[model samples]
Target: MYYQCFFFLQIDRQFLRISTVPLLSTFFAELDRYSPRLMEIFSRKGRQAGKEITQIMDAISKDDTIHTRRACVIKSLCTYLNEDPEKLVKAYLDSDFELQSTMEQTVMGVYVILIEGALPDDDPADIAVLIEGVEVLSDLNSIAQACALLFGLIYCLNLSYPQQLKCT
Candidate 1:
């Protein structure tokens, strides 16, 4: 019985390897055909557009009002995901007292929290991205970078977005 099981497993592995080659080749062929058009649509002056976008994002990230709005948005997203909004992220004033008090309330899951000062002119002190209560990234320079990283992670991990998000 053990030998038969081992033989079937080997045959399955070989079959998978043989079948995957054609699929991979076809996928790459399609990619090659479309890559130039994609580059044309997404690139400008050979990456100058990307730099300009990054600059704009950095400026937006520095705005205190935007940070406040983003915190609210995060809470809303948590609610949409059927998660506890309070557990998603907790914004705190960039003060030692507040930080010490709030540190104890951290929860598990993927989330981001912004620490900023009270003044409108003050930039965020920190932006942290956590997974399962462990910090994966912190003090990201711009919202764009953080977003790109999260998107890349989702793609690499083969995660599916929520149905509502996917429909949009």
Candidate 2:
């Protein structure tokens, strides 16, 4: 599903832009504009990247299909934001970031959904979500891993939840 979204197999074929830029730089750029908003949401649920276990619990609690799709949609929204970071911040007052809130929280919400329960188990599908959301991930390998996880999540969960239908 995620693969089809970004790199459609049979529809409008396009490539997912892999930023040659460093991951930390990309994360900081968004953080600069939306840190407070991101923090508020992150803190609301006590999200801590360091706390792997809690994060898994959070992901599991979220609506699985919603979480997966949101995580994937975030890629589309985030890529736009990445290309024109200044615009989304200065313009788009009804910003998707504002409407959707920070990029991180929404991604985390997706992560939570993939986990689908507080209890821990070694599930490849669950691990994929976490792989996709790793913030410091900068290299192509990491980005590829992220994409792979997203694809697996979406492919596995598509029937339960369809992608957001924004247009007619």
Candidate 3:
């Protein structure tokens, strides 16, 4: 049954891709024709955000650079949560951070774990998404992929975002 469900999911996802390609292409072509300046601004902003995210990720994945450069990244991450960077860093390093877990009780919700190497030459980091403290997905290739899956699970399960990260 699990295999059958997975097969259907794959088929559905492939069908979505097949059906949306031309629709998206036509939409974008029309938007470009209607407002070339708007399209250019969107393209430039997207490329700039992509480059910035890539730089931040690269810094985060490198243990040495992280020590010196993670301030901006950490601040950006915690901005929506209204969290203190020092405490968050400590909790993250100790593997004690949970999205919805507190000292008194653990809330039932999805959480993401990103494990990076201690050394610069080490292998790439691994990402995991858990629910109710149980890992549901592991060894995801990237934070983006893990986050995408996390959002998908939240939507599919009809779960609310964590309180602190509600704005995110």
- The TM-scores of all predictions, comma-separated, are 0.36, 0.20, 0.42
At residue 148, candidate 3 shows an lDDT of: 43
Model 1 clash pairs are: none
Candidate 2 lDDT, 59-161, residue by residue in tens: 4345444333333233323332222211111111222334323333333212221223333322222211222233222122222244433433343334222
Question: What's the distance in Å from true for residue 30, model 1?
Answer: 24
List all candidate RMSDs to the true structure: 14.8, 15.8, 10.1
lDDT of 3 by residue, 1-168 (tens): 111122223433543465543332343344335443532332344354544434534654555342223233433344323443222222122254553354224332223233443444343344455554555655554333444455555555567776654544
A best-first ranking of the candidates according to their lDDT comes to 1, 3, 2
lDDT of 1: 0.41
Residue 132, model 1: lDDT of 33
